[model samples]
Target: MRYRPVAFGLAVAALAAVSLTTPAQAKPAASSTTMANTTSAGTTATRVVTAAIPFGQNGDIPVARNYSGDSRYEIAVFRPSNGTWYIRGVGAYKFGQNGDIPVPADFTGDGRAELALFRPSNGYWYVRGVGQFTWGQAGDVPVPANYIGDSRAEAAVFRPSTGKWWIRGTAAIAWGRSGDIPVPADYLGDSHADLGVFRPATAQWWVRGAATIAWGVNGDIPVPANWVGTAKADLAIFRPSTGAWNLRGTSPVTWGTNGDRPQPGNYAGDTGTDQVVWRPSNGTWYLRYRVPITPPPPPPPNCDPSYPTVCIPPPPPDLNCGDITYRNFKVIGTDPHHFDSDHDGIGCES
Candidate 1:
């Protein structure tokens, strides 16, 4: 069909500003800025860049770059009132403000796209897909004994342990298939189960924090916070020395060393108030978050040179391909490059 790969980088940049205009009234021209350039490849290839441009006079709102691909775009919004941020994605043209926005991408090799959204009004995050779309709470969101100004909240994108997106907030993280109930004690990380790990064998949810805690059916444990979340489950790992966890995904549902064990926390918010806590023993104090199970790490990437080593060349070009190419291109211009063509998984993994 002789198709021209859309200008992904430019389009995402250009359109990002146009999408987030304030609805209250037409204000001054928003700030025009560039984010990063990304690359994608397949039968056809093109470059894609995602920019977070200021949309309103205050430039407080952020919209993800516009692009054409199986990839899903996520945007994090901040509310100045509470200094809180929230994220939502899964839709093509509009933001998934209340419900899950569905974007199609086979990030986990499951052959389907995952959609998620964070709703600050109710302090609940929602996920939708081929199977289910349900809402779960982020753990630490201070339901504030009293109402606050506008109840504004912000969010960030999260790939849940369930091989899907989980929104992080000032509260707890919720995960699992749509319609499936999430546990309170399992999720971890920023108040909202924004980032976490899952232990399939132990069925525990772990999160990165100053202390890194592991959440599971039995209880939560303390781990290193160096590990980051990734698209694949279980693949998330942590370093013993730096105490860093690799980016695997939010739902790291497996435990390696200790079966589900609880971590210690200060109930009265005092370091001196330190007390050992566990589930069932203190259910009210704990929150639950679902995570996708992951296979074990890939045998240390076969560092053994003696075995057959497959040499992988640098990645090919990224031809932004999809229906929104033209629409997104008009907005982005080709000047700076912000694309991750290598597809080693890390965006701009330079």
Candidate 2:
């Protein structure tokens, strides 16, 4: 469901979103993107970014890249109609045209991902840092992964006509039948992704060298991530029919509605994975993203050192003992406030 464009309305019909492609609407306040709403499970999430996708072409999915190596993924939306890309945090970039499926990933073993595309027209792959090369034929679905645990994703494809997987430098392996959706990820907790697919007809998932499970039903997209914060990736399915994400050992969450792509990532820079759903219908992305805890600010620089317990600004017009709420507090140094007139260690002595 994520690889192709389908007609479905998301849950962002009421929000007044600003279009990034067209003239920016009357700029929204800094906190405009902040969505402090709690989920049905009583989980509160805050949206930090709310950039809109291009108009007319509502088939584009928001691509996330953690090229900063900070574990925080940035959102990037690619417009297939004009080869234009609008990254929320980063600037815009155009590297591919219409019909080119965006499969950006880490391909240089740099511990980060990059913007790349797999052209289905010529069966070629064009990576940003790496050079361009050919891998599969036309109509083949792009299934890239880090097959060698090098932190770099390799080129792979799933041929629908043959129901086989074709990896770079390897022979075609028959594992799934036609109509099965290709889902390649690190399911073994070994850092290397396995070639797998989900059969909608049976709702069964078959992973190479791993156990098979029937977790999702028809019309569900496979979106795997490190949900439990362990080695292996967890099995998860985004059900568009009900707009619910079904994950093992957790409650079913209803975030985005139909036609929204599952974009699970660690956007909060926390230990758990954030469940995000980008609606291509209105170019709106709804994220079950929690805001990180912020540390308290440092003391004022002009505060006098004499009052270590409380911050007291340097005196220009001398102050009395009743100026502040301090009484019998520790007083040292020059005693700028002169509260310690008796030369005692305590200030504002009663």
Provide the overall lDDT of each model, using Cα atoms, as 2-decimal numbers. 0.27, 0.73
Off by over 4 Å in 2: 1-57, 291-350
Q: What is the Cα root-mean-square deviation between model 1 and the actual structure?
A: 25.2
Pairs of residues at least 3 apart in sequence or in different chains that clash in candidate 2: none
How much is 350 displaced in model 2, in angstroms? 34
- Provide the clash count, candidate 2: 0
TM-score of 1: 0.21
Tens digit per residue, CA lDDT, model 1, 224-290? 2212221112222332233232323443322122221222222222111111112222111111111
Deviation from native of the Cα of residue 242 in model 1, angstroms? 21
Cα-based lDDT at residue 323, candidate 1: 14
Q: How does each model score on TM-score?
A: 0.21, 0.68
Best by TM-score: 2
